[model samples]
Target: MIPEELLLKYTAETKRFQKDEIIFSEKQTAHYYYQIVSGVVKMNNFNDDGKEFIQGVFYKNQSFGEPPLFIDVKYPANAVAISDSTVLALSKSNLFKLLQDNPETHLKITQSLAKRLYYKAIIASEISSQEPAHRVLRFIDYLKDDVYKVEGKYSFKVAYTRQQMADILGLRVETVIRVIKSLEKKGDVKISKRKVYR
Candidate 1:
């Protein structure tokens, strides 16, 4: 991710968005490079039958929707705030110049996008071949791996709700609930005071 000082230098302002607010819609022209300053955001899309699919969730200090900005293409998915959120939005042109001036920051962006692509590849096979419980465990394990990279720790609270997990994994909310309880029973996951840890 780019540094906050550098992002603000390009945007000149921070904007607030409420929960469930659409930040951008699918097929819209990509115009801004966004970084979440506070709260959560989800990149998602709907299928032809109106089923919702979550591409990814981002937290504070995380950036989303970068590929379109770099390639000058329409957004393929919508971004929406999952909670009351503040975001810094940099103009695409300004962001490009910032990247040009800072090769290290550009490298960070490249690595970030590559990481997401790797996650997508794993998830594609998981969803296509795994059972609900298997898929759910794989998802949590994937997140655990990411946390391990950052903190060198194994346990972390899940940032998403059951419904959100269901949406992302192409399962029913009931299925997610059942799988979570099953995981708890199997000692694969721990749910303490309603917060999940793995």
Candidate 2:
């Protein structure tokens, strides 16, 4: 990730977005480099039947929607605030120049993007071939590190809602609810005050 100082130097201002607000829509021109300073963001799209598909979710200190900027392509999905959020928005050209000046940061960005590509490939296969339980488990496992910082007993909270989980895993929300309840009954996860722990 780009350092805060460097980002600040390039970012003219911090943009604030309310929960559920659209930062940018699908097919919009890619113009800025965005880094989350607080809260969460999700890049997603709707299908023909209006079903949502979540492409990615990012939290504080993370970045999103950079691939299109590099490729000079329109955004493939909409970026929305998952909560009240602040984002540092830099001109794409300035970001590119900054990366050019700092090869180390550029290399880190490359590695990060590559890791995301690999994750997408794995998720695509799971969505196409896995059962609901399998898909749910796989998706949770994928986000385990992000959602939880396990120290002793595998206890961790799920960062997303059931509907968000369904969108990410390509399952119906009802199916996600049933599978989670089943998981809880089977002792695969624990639900405490609506928070899930594994």
Candidate 3:
């Protein structure tokens, strides 16, 4: 992610958003490079019947909704504050200038986008052909092996709620609950004090 000082140097504004506020909607122009200063944000889309599909979740220090800046396309999903949050937003032109002035930062942004693309490809495959149990387990494994880098059994505490998991994985909430219980029985995960660990 771009450093805070660099963002400030580029005249990035620190904006605050309340919980559930829409930062930008789907098809809106991608005029800013946003980095989280606090709290959580999610990029998502809703279906005709109002079912939510989470594209990604970002926490403090992470960047979201930048892929469109590189592609010159409008945002494909809406960015919303999951909690009251502060974010730094740099105009697209300012971002270009900052990147031109810092080749290393440009490379870093490219690498970050590539990783997200890789994750999308992996999840897309899972949603397309995998069973509910397999999708749930693989998603957990992705977080364990890639995101958190935790290895030992039940060492990673899951932070997402069942409904959030269902949205992200394109499954029903009931399915996620059942899958978690099934994973527990299969020794694939551990549920303790109503918290899940993997």
Candidate 4:
């Protein structure tokens, strides 16, 4: 991610978006580089049958929709605020200028994008051949270890709702609920007060 000071130097503007608001839509021109300053955002798409498929959920300090900016292509998914959120938006031209002037920051951005690609690969494999319980467990484990960096079993609290998990994993909401409860019975996760911990 580009530092805020640098983004500001490149004329990045702070913008606020409300929950369920569409920040940018699929097929829209990639005009700005978006970085979340507060709250949650999701890049998602809807199927013809009205099923929602979440491409990814982004939290504070994370950047989304970068590939399109670098390649000069339209965004393939819509960016929406999951909660009332604050974001920094920089023009595509300004982002290129900032990167060109800052080699270290550019490298960091590349690494961030690489991690996203890696996560996508893992999800693809999990969705294809894994059983329901295994898929959910693996996804939660990845979030705990790599994304949240929390240690110890059942020490990390899962913040994503069951519906969100189902959307991302390509499972039905009922399946996600059942799998989580099954996981709890098996001692793979701990559920208390309806929140899952792992």
Candidate 5:
């Protein structure tokens, strides 16, 4: 859990955003590191052909903007809210101040960074050898083990859309849809009204 003082400081600078609202644009200077207090945010990049690719989805309690904070650079991707969201923003200077005042906080951030690196490695390994369907299955397993729960045949509180899932898995949207449908046919999973059950 984050420290209460840190939470208070963040709450003071936090703001609310509605669905589809652009939180920040690509190449924009990263002045603030944000922690999601509620809802979801998607980070994406667009190629020269204007084809958009999602980089990641950040859900509640997740922290982002670390790349910019560490490099003292602009954001490499744009961030947009996928639903009504409330995010706590801490300026670079303020964050540094907090870290300076609390060495433990800095260590905690380092641990978080290490965990992210480990997860990234796993994602790369899985995407390299798995078929699209298997990729989706592995992703679901990760979600179940790391993010949420699977009770009987139902999974609850999934925070990603099909497109976002495709982006994370490095698969095309149509491929994702087809793989999901195939899983449904196999009785491995089910999709109803955009909710997936396994």
Candidate 6:
């Protein structure tokens, strides 16, 4: 984890949010770089038809809001708390000052940006080159790795609803349900309320 002193030097404020609370709206000015200290945050994009699509989900210890901050643009998506969450907020000026003061931190930030770009590339490739089922499978695989624990049986707690899952995978709700059913039929996964066993 990044050192607390470094974070404190850059951060100007801190905020807490409850589950399902909106952190920011699409087109909102990017004033601060936010770091999640605990819980989860979901970033989503909406279409003109009022359909929402999830862009990404951030877990504990993750940072966001940098891209738009660097670009000096409005936030491209809306961000919401998936659970009770706390975030460190660094204003744009503070971020710039930190980067200027710590060259090493600037390098680290650049590397982080590069990694994010790579992930976006991977997602784009998967969307164009892989079948919808395979894309969903890949997403499931990611969730399994990120959120599950394995013992005698695989069990996981999901942070989002089925509809949210569908949005995250860029699939229709029916298609998401179908894939879940398929996984259940194959004995690869079992859903019990909010828990999934695989």
Residue 146 of model 3 has an lDDT of 80
| Model 5 alpha-carbon miss at residue 134, Å | 1.6
Whichever of 2 and 6 has more lDDT, that candidate is: 2
C-alpha lDDT score of every prediction, in listed order: 0.88, 0.87, 0.93, 0.94, 0.80, 0.77
- Residue 173 Cα positional deviation in candidate 1, in Å, after optimal superposition: 1.0
Best by lDDT: 4
Better of 2 and 5 by TM-score: 2
**Count of backbone collisions within predicted model 5:** 0
Model 2 C-alpha lDDT per residue in residues 11-81, reported as the tens digit of each score: 54699999999999999999998999998999999999988899989998889999999998999999999
What is the alpha-carbon lDDT of model 2 when measured against the actual structure? 0.87
Candidate 3: residue pairs that collide: none
How would you encode candidate 5's per-residue C-alpha lDDT over 61-97 as one tens digit per residue? 8887677888888898999998999988887788778
Which pairs clash inside model 6?
none
Q: Highest TM-score: give the candidate number.
A: 4
By lDDT, the better pick of 5 and 6 is 5
TM-score of each: 0.94, 0.93, 0.95, 0.96, 0.83, 0.78
Compose the digit string of candidate 4's lDDT tens values, residues 76-134.
99999999999999998999999999999999999889888888999999999999998
Q: Candidate 1 overall Cα lDDT vs. reference?
A: 0.88
Provide the lowest-lDDT 10-residue window in model 2. 145-154
Indicate the residue-level lDDT of 153 in model 6: 48
Model 5 regions lying over 4 Å from their true place: 1-5, 10-12, 148-157
Worst 10 residues of 6 by lDDT: 146-155
RMSD of each: 1.7, 1.8, 1.2, 1.0, 2.7, 3.4
Writing each residue's lDDT as its tens digit, candidate 3 over 1-198 gives: 788999999899999999999999999989999999999999999999999999988998899999889889999999999999999999999999999999999999988888888889999999999999999989888888887689898999988888988999999999999999999999999999988999
Selected candidate, larger lDDT, 2 vs 3? 3
